[model samples]
Target: MGTGKRRPLGDRYQLISPTGRDGPGIIWRAHDLRLRRDVAIKEIQPLFRADGADLDGARRRAMREARSAARLSHPAVVAVHDLLEEGGRLWIVMELLEALTLKETVAHLGHLPVHWTAWIGFQLLGGLRHAHGAGVLHRDINPGNILLTGDRVVLADFGIAALNGDPSASTTVPLHCAPAYVAPERLRGLTASPAADLWSFGASLYFAVEGRPPYPGSDSLAVLGEAVNRDPDPPVKAGPLRRVLEGLLRRDPSDRITADHAARLLSAILRMEGVAVDPPRLPAARLPPDSFAR
Candidate 1:
């Protein structure tokens, strides 16, 4: 990322450097003048060359990302601080998370060990559980959106997140999310639920162990078709995680394993192999009775 000048937003956030892009915006590491801290600011640039309708949709999605993420508070989820509209663009203020995305980590390392992948999955499932309880469906769960920060795994980018029963969210786009990670039911135009997210998680876990998506293809259309019409290839390196992966990637959501069940299996994996790093803060395989009961 290149920097030209120190741009100020709302007279509080001082943009210092570019981080990366997420959803429809460019993320910058900015300084909070009032709080004396660094923060991540997502700048949704206006589509100057596009018509009014296209620009409006982008703005709506960007705003939704802020609002949806703001509703959740969890260790494994990114924190949204505020949202502002300035100079004809939307800026989302968020906690400055200094971490590498799971995608980047996997690309550099080829594949992660089974216990390590289980640790990552365990944290993400907790985050997804919390989001679902809040009626916010991530709709997008892939390696690119999973962040690894030391002992924590944070789920980021709620740009296309849909509140349960909110039809408008589903209407934002004809299709959403990375093709290989999309749930089979989503490809068939079915309503997305927590189960859909689990399917995507399963795909991500498969990638972590197999070094490729189960339904790999050269294009989106072909991959989406395979997801909906066929079963994923059997795992060759999942080892102890084979059962859990199969449970999650089942095409029928009804047959999909519940978060609690998945958590139990993940915890078992950690217990059997033992984690090499500090354990996650939260207790493994346990959720509040009122929040997530499968």
Candidate 2:
């Protein structure tokens, strides 16, 4: 169970090969011996240093990710099957999705069709709505975290997600977030909010239709500066999705469109149906009590 050692989990989940790595975790494609299926296992450790604080932080983040994602029961959200701790390392077992990330998809097929982008946006917004209602804020919602499974879109990687009313939700950890997708308010040292996720959603959709991030630069600092100081160049290929993107990307959180409003607009565009337009009211359901407080 130590580093560089390959060990089965409870006589099942034989590790096959390394699939990818995220922040402080290594993802492995494994065979679930009991279920006779393939699963993705994420191994998290403080590989850089043996400092007690760093390892403790990594453990907390892994637990937070599992708890946050476990409460969300939506088809568009990746399922978390199990969490394990062995030899001071944490492992998370998830459904192995046979798909490509939105980032990979855009790289393969530049500038997705307008209707198709709207449909993808609609699905993502649905998942976001559900998460928000459940009081979970998916702080990181970029293209790389969105997966395309066949025709369905699923949001993956809740590593930095936060629950409402948690003190840690407001603490800024720059390394855990993507520079270009970070909200203007977040750049200004504000707390992470649902609006921040909306901004990221807008940026993601912009990348889908434009084949590039809204804020492009040579380095992380440059990208962050652009995100905080300038408006994204108008998207030429967004077509019907233009307005939705605009509303979500508003610099001021108060001015940005609510999740319900964005969903309504995207839904209309997706179905090719028409609806009268007006400002949307807050959803009736209040944010749920913290479900991750175990």
Candidate 3:
């Protein structure tokens, strides 16, 4: 999705700066003309034009991002202020976050303090809890998807899968997740579960501490097989964290840590970091076939 026209996107938004490139989309800082507040807009890339063969299918996938985003209304997830389709392109207007992504933090600071990692883990679990409540599965959960602004933490991308944006039927396999974060079932063309999100979350935590993925290799299949059939190298032996990671990376989805269990386990870490966590919000709709509790 290009700027479309030469004019700066309507008078309603003034482009302040370009953040960076994201696999999910490209984000820009702009001022919301109506609200007079800074906001971010993540518009689909020009991939649609490049892969022009599947124009029809790509259109629906773009629509799915907006739909899934609209289903969620929480502080932790980036708020979807508006979704627009014009000039044969789709754009998502989201809450402009002032903080850096976990990816950037790790890149610049190397490994973070254990407390910080634990705190981030708590926020991610809480966010996932809320997402599950909403009947949404964030098949993609990694360091890049989590953001921290000042003291506030939010999970940026919640729901995504082949059903939503993939040109194919397997949305669980996001290009952004790489091989290190995918669950075992996902690789087999299976739908996503909250437990799968937990598994990815655990892998992200490993990245934070170890600076390496649980399954590090060039081949996607090789990494996934190790992720499913083998155990991850232990974290830096940081007490409950080590145990927490072990449980999170469990090969069996049922054996993995539950979101509730994760929240409870991380409560201490949250308090120790002087972080006051708000309860997660659930989607208004009732349960689905893949209900977390069910």
TM-score (all chains, Cα) for each model: 0.89, 0.89, 0.83
TM-score of 2: 0.89
Name the candidate that leads on lDDT.
Answer: 1
- Winner on TM-score between 1 and 3 is 1
lDDT of 1: 0.82
Error of 3 at 197 (Å): 0.9
For model 3, state the Cα shift of residue 238 in Å: 3.2
Candidate 1 pairs with clashing backbones: none
Write one digit per residue (lDDT tens) for candidate 1, span 1-294. 445364578888988888898865689999999999999988876544444436676688777888899988998899999898877778899999889999888899988899889999988888887887777788888889999999789999898888876766563224436778988888877888778888989999999888888898778888877877999999989999999999999989988998778888888888899664343333343443343345
With a 3 Å backbone cut-off (N, CA, C), the pairs that clash in candidate 2 are none
lDDT of 3 by residue, 124-214 (tens): 6765666677666677777788888866678775335323222444634755567678877676677667778788888888788666677
lDDT of each: 0.82, 0.82, 0.70
Lowest lDDT 10-residue stretch of candidate 3:
158-167
Instruction: Please give, for residues 28-139, the per-residue lDDT of candidate 2 as tens digits.
Output: 8998989999999998866355544477877888999899989888877899998988878888999998888998999999878888788788877777878888888888
Question: TM-score of model 1 relative to the true fold?
Answer: 0.89
Tell me which residue pairs clash in candidate 3. 134-283, 161-171, 162-170, 162-171
